[model samples]
Target: MIAPLMKQAGRFSETTVDGEVVLLNLDDGAFFSLTGTAAEIWALIDGARNREAVIAELAARHNADHAAVAADLDPFLADLQARGFLAGA
Candidate 1:
């Protein structure tokens, strides 16, 4: 089973500023900003890419350690999930 986190429909709007992705939640008018690698991660969650696929891409793109990136990604994704910015995995 390849489960991926999908961005919630009609829940948020986004803008990019100086390389950061700023997401605004429509429900509560909450604004969340994702920068650097986090922005890249956000771009990958389009209902097509799985978590491992995202981790792989991020690792290759940054020449980063896979485990380390995964460690960071998990919590960030969880935060997004908690905020209702994501539909589910």
Candidate 2:
């Protein structure tokens, strides 16, 4: 079976400055600021990878544990989705 993907949703504008990402949600006029690992995680959910794949890649890239990364990432992803920032979540 094909896995579910996390894809960007709604209309938005984003900019990166000093390694941090500032995102503006055009639909709702909400703004988000993502720094450090949060910025990295935002960049990874490009509609190409599933939740497990994202977790694995992040864990490997950061030399962190898969379970630990998943524990943190799951809630973050959910929040983004709940806020209409993500589709196919």
Candidate number with greatest lDDT: 1
lDDT minimum window of 10 residues, candidate 1: 80-89
| Per-residue lDDT over 1-89 for candidate 2, one digit per residue giving the tens place of the 0 to 100 score | 55666556556778899998988888888998989888999998877788888898999999999999999998998877776678756
Could you tally the backbone clashes for each prediction? 0, 0
lDDT score of residue 36 within candidate 1:
75
Which residue pairs collide in model 2, if any?
Answer: none
**CA lDDT of 47 in candidate 1?**
90
RMSD of each: 1.3, 1.6
How do all models score by TM-score?
0.89, 0.86
Best by TM-score: 1
Error of 2 at 41 (Å): 0.8
The lDDT of each candidate is 0.89, 0.83
Q: Residue 8 of candidate 1: its Cα lDDT?
A: 89
